[model samples]
Target: MARFTHSNKHTYTGTLLLLSCLALIGAALIADFMLASSSYSPAYLSIASKWAREKSGFIVVPNLNASKVGQKESMAVKDKAERIPERSLSATFADLPAPELEWEQMPSAPVPRLDGAAIQIKNLFYVFAGYGTLDYVHSHVDVYNFSDNKWVDRFDMPKEMAHSHLGVVSDGRYIYVVSGQYGPQCRGPTARTFVLDTKMRKWRSMPPLPAPRYSPATQLWRGRLHVMGGSKENRHTPGLEHWSIAVKDGKALEKEWRTEISIPRGGPHRACIVIKDRLFVIGGQEGDFMAKPGSPIFKCSRRHEVVYADVYMLDEEMKWKTLPPMPKPNSHIECAWVIVNNSIIITGGTTEKHPVTKRMILVGEVFQFHLDSLTWSVIGKLPYRVKTTLTGFWDGWLYFTSGQRDRGPDNPQPRKVIGEMWRTKLHL
Candidate 1:
């Protein structure tokens, strides 16, 4: 209320204006620092919203609880982003490729044939009678020495020996050749059995079976030679009979084959293996080649075949039990077991016919059956589809020789029998 002067009034107004400008500048700098520290903070968002509304002539309200929720959401997003790479890394490691298995070609067999028998005795591999070209049957044995990697010797089989479809097995020193097709081309089977002494290279007659079977499954188990499941004399008829004969020193201790528990499913071309007193028979067919009636030459009759994937196990109690079947139907894989890592591996056999073409499809996948889990998995593949492949496992390598290969679309005949041998390092 003092007397006013013009100069004093101007000076007072100037001082108030300068102080207001300094205060506004300080507030703007503080707001910039808060936004840089946490742009998603509710307070900063509220200020931005307020500025936007003022510029756009709209209403805005600050939500206090949104600040806490925004912080939690931001932390969750950051944590998820950090964990994504760890999961990806773990998946990458799990999907690493299986060890590469490369197959190497070995020396070919002395003679190319089909429906033959093979057995491994230490370093020597013996190839027995088989069907040659044009309905001819071979009655000879070819011996291959793995150490020398060559066909070491060839010897004539006994005159009474069956030429094809013989059930053959070895006991480290002696080879037991059982009943099979006596001659060739849909001919009848023989009940006579014989044993070959590998060391002496001599064949001796054994007791005969009650009846003849074509391509029977034979194995030596617990001092007894077990024979079971083949086509009967009718050829197309499935034989369920199981027989065994006691033997020692390559001679049958019994005068005749003794009857035993019959197999669950039976025909021929099944793979049989004995593991720790358990007998496992896997994959076979219901029908086989038949001889046409009144045909002097016993020409094969056109027939329908029912391939199966049934698996059975003979337990210690002498009882048959069912097991998990193969992933697909497989047959003509008489001796295809490679025991590795408590699992049995079977390769190269005939599977189901092609659905479209209704033609036989040979197997190429290497199948693994885990003994403990009783599960099946496809581990790898063969170089090509094949059947009747004689397989042997030695020194961590799998060897296969003598099989009928797949002749492509041009070949009218389904089988192109080969003598080529192959080996590959087994990696499971």
Candidate 2:
């Protein structure tokens, strides 16, 4: 019985030795495959390293293509870092390196008004007639002194001068005030043209327009005062008439305005600018608020206003050519231009109405029109949305004051007309 038991034990020991040898041979095959194959996965390396550590008590380092793996990982990180999110219409301007762009509020004007015209001569900003509260029209001039940062002077305008919508321009010393609405709301325009001598602070009559116009785009170009586009007598119809007259020393050389080529798209509240003798008209609306036919012409309604972004330029060849339209349509932005870095910067006007609310949408963006490139870009924004904002540029600063401000950020409807002035440094 003892001899039979000893034989069975010997057979069992031999079987165990055979199984151990086969397991070692299988592990050797797996290790060889992991080291030899270039396409071996990370999982294979992990399993091989685990087996080697458990059996031999030594770590197995993977022979991965370190350079290629590093390069691929680095490229993935770079791509993620360089990705830029898409911007929206209301996005803030960020083309240039951002500077300190906070707006500083200045002293408010004496009286709040809208549709006013302002021009800077030296250090003085002359604010002309505008529409006041409750159908009242301001027929006076408020002069602001930059040195003192205060409203320094106030003077009465000519009784014959129109109260609002006057096309005003300055030639250092002389200010040409052209045709405009003579009275309050819905009043017919006047053909009487006047020039203000800043040195003398005196008013002189110039050759009147062939017919009166409302908010005509007026600018001085090569010794000639050019006037083009405005609303007609009905206050709703657009007038495409263009006229000019030779002028030296604020007085027209001719007795009558010579008719010239009409503007392509005629409307009111457009900015007229002359850069390098090139005439450009931009941003106006076709229809204006119309007066309801009644005993009093003060009652009005904005039933048919259509703002547009169309831009037109009159070249030296005496032909009008269409330029690229604005980033968005704008109106009630007459006389809003500040020349900086070979570009014209316009700010704050009425854009198209809100799609959902059907209310007027005021513009808060600072638009830059590059003369060299003829391109439009939203460079910055205002503190809030506004329309008819009086603009001035002085000593590396852009100033704006006196306009109708929007209700709130959530509400685009216009709320109140303000005379508060604000300015920001132009980091050119």
Candidate 3:
């Protein structure tokens, strides 16, 4: 009986040793497979390297040589500003006739206001969400039909987003309203983002912006919504941060906010437009308005602020190239800017304070920049001096409406506001 019990114990000890050896062999095989895969596969090496970098707090700079190939292929961008024509920065209006344009008067808008954004999509012009008389902020949406040539009150905005100064961009179907100011009294900024579907005429909330801002030069580029240059609280606090949101199938993707390098100062009220693969940032105000003797409320500056005459172009490589400054600095306000007939047309903006009166004067000047020639020329002037006019371009017509007229001492509003809608066939 003793001998049989001893035999059973030996058998149990042998089985335990075999199981332990098998476990170690399995672990060894797994370790070998992992090491082999990582050493042989580029993808595995990349993922492991990324993980290591994240854990080690080390950043690996991309190889510039490898990136250039992808950049040239993906963007198909043109060369730098060296390609532009070398000519006099200022164009002369000596022989240029009044631009070949046909003027037409449209029906009055239900709400006569300024500081509102006008965007045209498929022949329909949507205009509203600006301050009215007596400092009244509007939430109503007013749409104008080109075929019918009439204005219709469509619907109210989801919230009070008046005087935002921020503009809207479209992806052929959805119109995105970016962050803007909500305070009607102080003209403060807010970080509210929304989108409106023209088909349904409904506004839906999207992710809010990283910071509150107003008057941002926003646009759609390369399937992303690029929000650049504005102000945080007032025009003084220039928004230096650049953010982009990737939208897929009319919806902003989750966790898609990308922060790029900061732009130059004086970003507010700047005219930003994407031509081909380059983004052109034109005149803007460097400083903001401050209180002065006799003028207690908000009003235009008195020749104290710096108006940017410098034209900055952002290339496909994300580098900014300085172009020849405009002959006349037309910053501090939004100029009538449009790209047409391979030319850039800007007109009717307030210039620096009049040399004599020390008061900023409304301008009636019109200028054109030829893309092919890379030259600028004076294209005569508008029929009337105008500034801060809500403007848009569709097909071949440039639409402008309801700008503030110069106010005299008797006027109650700081500036006299208008409500007229005018359209003209712009010869590019």
Candidate 4:
């Protein structure tokens, strides 16, 4: 029996040794398989390199050589400023008639006021959320039918006297109203952000801005909405920062406004246009306005009325460059801007101050800056002493309206805001 037990023990030891050797061999095979699988795949290298990674549910890959593309530092200047033909201010007076355009009057809005905003969508004109004397700025949203020269009252602004100077942007389905003033007094600012769902025909709260502010300029970039150049104190600031907001899966996300390389000291009232992914800040008050004896409220040349004659470009590199200057000085130009035929055309805005009130002048003149040429030339203007601010389009016709008309001291028309619509066409 002792002899049998010794033999059995030897057999069991040999079996155990065999099993351990087999297990090691299997493990070594698996290790080699994993190493080969990872090494042979170039796609897995994409996961390893973080530089080209973009994962916001969009899963877009950044161009790996984008940084290597040396910047085109300098551009040959092509555009030049020409003489201001006297025909611009009095085009309809048979002075400077554009060969393609025949100027005439259009029906007016129901109410007479300035500072109102009008937006065009799918061939319909939606004018709303502006402020003027009817006690305080208006809350009533008016819709004008250019086809029939009729008016319809839609939804009133959620709040009152929110003389909102901000523009609206939409994806053809949802219209987003950005930041502006809420209280009758500009002292009280509003950070409210509202979105109107055209499909639902209802208002929904997306997100409120970080602070109550007005004149928040917004544009869409790389599928994200970017807003820049606004006020914290209702005047010029070294603090006019740039911010970006994004919408994903129908939910909105915002980043804090970051000071982006200090944009030139352009006023919030400046005319800004985004052409070819570049932000052009043109035609605005240059100096910051603070309420005081020599502030912008005072209209002093160095203090309040520093007109922006040069065009500043914020290119894709996010750098600022001074472009060609306008022929004449321009400021407080009411809606002195209009975008037509892929070119930014600017018309009547006050180039001079009022002799008596010392306020910004109400000049009826026009200019066109061809984006490709980066040059300027005087265009067409209205015949009468036209005032402006709210400028937009309707019924295939360019319409201008809602500006402050200059009234003499005895005019008592201090609040005599005018709301007239002048319709014209953009000659190619």
Candidate 5:
């Protein structure tokens, strides 16, 4: 408003430029205010409609009052609590059970002997008369004391009966030895019967068996020595007849041998055990069978002999009843059988039957038969192939003495003998 002198041209131009910049800034602020107010103002209707249509797909609809993350976390926690029940989880964990079987290996026996006469008198296991080697039979008696876990030398068996295949039974105080073979395969069997007074460590002669037999299944039942199936002439020809002799005054009485029912199929190498006053006879070798007339294999071969897997039960009424047979054929050729936990266990036997060969396959498969269910299951197996092995049960352990091992598959070789003794404890 004050009166001013005339300025330079440059000063005038600078003032004009500053005014122009101010005007542009004012216009920009007015445009921003108008656009911001367009949501409610009627003047910007067209522009607002176009912007809403274009930005509809890209619009972010946000919940201002409630946080999205917090809502999701709350829903997850509620669903988990509703789905999972505490009582159900607790019951599931509580119903779980523990395992059943456990086996423990124990100390070994002193010497290696197969087909030995083994009987338990008190806590001592008497092992007598067995095949020591392929060429020799043993007469020395070894007593294993379970209390001390050591072996003691007992009186050797009589010199005349250095034998194997002896049928042995115990009367707690005395052990009775029945028919046996003097030597190995094909050797003639002896009928000489003897009783060993364990307390006196002496052997005394008794009335012998009516005829010589080997591997007879012998059992002392009701004051009588019962003898059953065994080889009379050879391993192939098994004696089917059954005989029993009464015992009195710790000796075989003057009573002659009485006859009982004979075996249905003759199998000399049979395994017999007494359960619940009944006798169970298990697998053995039942000779051979002829080939069928119209079979392809029969056209080439006339006869093929198979091993036996038969099972029979003898009741107290002198009656014989057939039972379920073994799952596999057993050519015990030589084996050991025992009863544990109400189950009949058979070990160290072969199943193979060659139509033409002198060689026999050996196995260590341990098979167990459950009396209740009458089913067979494999419990465990021996480390090495075993045949003609001696077995004893004491405390809770099963002792396996020396037996024959298989030589490599070279048709036929002398079976290797094992000196190692193994024992396994059965955990209930």
Candidate 6:
């Protein structure tokens, strides 16, 4: 094994050098094994699993980031998965020096902004684009170097990306961003793509999305970046067109936009992730509940709210199937996910009446999904129930910040916009 010093204070554990080499082996072996056994491919997965054992940590969790996201049970006739052990994972949110959230006075963003965002990388937090009240995507990028307990402005996103369909993922090198919205109010057609080099402070353009969609939760699977559901033309008619682009040489491509198997016409803004070789999508706005076994995407549209406990998964053959469903119907939260102890650990998102609601509401909550049995249940709740704009997990503890809550229709109601703050761990 070879070791090299990374500028970031956190130690890399000497495994990153061979990460790509091992990933290539895993991909190749898995592909071959799939060819031999159409339906079953264990031996190929074994090779990939072996390579993953050594290098997955470097690629998956390179540093500490703040973000956060689940499912239910089923035991029907043949080929049904068994009951998963209902787990209540006690979270471990580390306490920060300063306390921000309050019930009386409105908490303010470290910087006055909403929709502007943050990301954690190499043991630090980076805040970027969010729209101002006048509706302009800020070009300045503010980074919270948690290690040094200070804020630093590194580099702005490729261009102005405000109210855009934001999706970001990192491979410990480049911070790949997909965000673009056009028009006067930013509620227009947007098609833009950019890649930021965290080290060199550079940005590059790539192929844009086939359509101008926003607010879709993105999932990275097997070296390819997948953009999940988000609404485009008609907010009510959410697009199930799943778009993906291959990334190579520190660049994310916009071309080769393949709209594979559409989701169950279950609407958009659902929490999406690929776990254990299966893609799991949770919750969305305005979709049917009573979907028959082999029904099309838009099966039931009578329901008012598209949100539901419905959790869908795509098998190896790319067939969409529903899972046990969630504890309740939830949509439009800062739903990011991280795996802990073989369970999906989901953290803070706005589960209230509105994402920008300023009034006090208990939307800050956490839950888990046990892959083995695949059941859903609440684990713990955030100490302060606030609808944060964004969430991500890194290093161990979960971090969330930078979103507005309803201030209510009143006189001089101040909306709280957090620049960057971490969880106060109510009861981890």
Which numbered prediction scores highest in lDDT against the true structure?
2
Clashing residue pairs in candidate 1 (N, C-alpha, C atoms within 3 angstroms) = none
**How do the residues 298-361 of candidate 2 rate in per-residue lDDT, one tens digit apiece?**
5766667778877899877999998877766788888677778888999889876643345677
lDDT of model 2 at position 398: 88
Worst 10 residues of 6 by lDDT: 62-71
Model 2 TM-score?
0.76
> Who is ahead in lDDT, 2 or 5?
2
Candidate 2 or 6, higher TM-score? 2
Candidate 5, residue 253: the lDDT equals 80
Scored by Cα lDDT, where does model 1 land?
Answer: 0.76
Q: How well does candidate 4 match the true structure in TM-score terms?
A: 0.64
The whole-model lDDT of each prediction reads: 0.76, 0.79, 0.62, 0.54, 0.63, 0.52
Candidate 3 lDDT: 0.62
lDDT of candidate 6 over 146-253, digit per residue (tens): 455455555555444534335666666776666434322334435676677778888887787787665565666666777766666433446667877878767754
The prediction achieving the highest TM-score against the true structure is 2
lDDT of 5 by residue, 131-200 (tens): 7664577777888776676676656788766388778878789888888877643355788888888888
lDDT of 3 by residue, 1-428 (tens): 12436658877777777888998999866765554333323532342243233222323332223322322333434765422212111111111233434568878777777666667677787776766753566677788877677886568888645454765777767888887767453455677788888888777777778887667777778778888777666556667788888886568886656897677764567677778878777777665543343544454343255555667777778877876555455653443576778777776566555322345555555767676765566665554656666666777777777656544322212366667777877654
The lDDT, on a scale of 0 to 1, for candidate 2 is: 0.79
Q: After superposition, which runs of candidate 6 have C-alpha atoms over 4 Å from their true positions? A: 1-113, 116-118, 134-136, 160-163, 180-186, 234-236, 252-254, 266-268, 287-305, 334-336, 352-362, 406-415, 424-428
Q: Which tens-of-lDDT digit does each residue in 100-201 have in candidate 1? A: 368899999988878888888888888888887638889898988877778899999999888887888877898999999888788988988999999888
Please report how far candidate 1 places residue 331 from its true position, in Å.
0.4
Backbone collisions counted per model: 0, 0, 0, 0, 0, 32
Off by over 4 Å in 5: 1-110, 287-306, 333-335, 354-358, 408-414
Off by over 4 Å in 4: 1-102, 147-149, 234-239, 248-251, 255-261, 286-305, 332-336, 352-357, 385-388, 394-396, 407-415
Give one digit per residue, the lDDT tens place, for model 4 in 294-324. 4432331224545445567877787789876
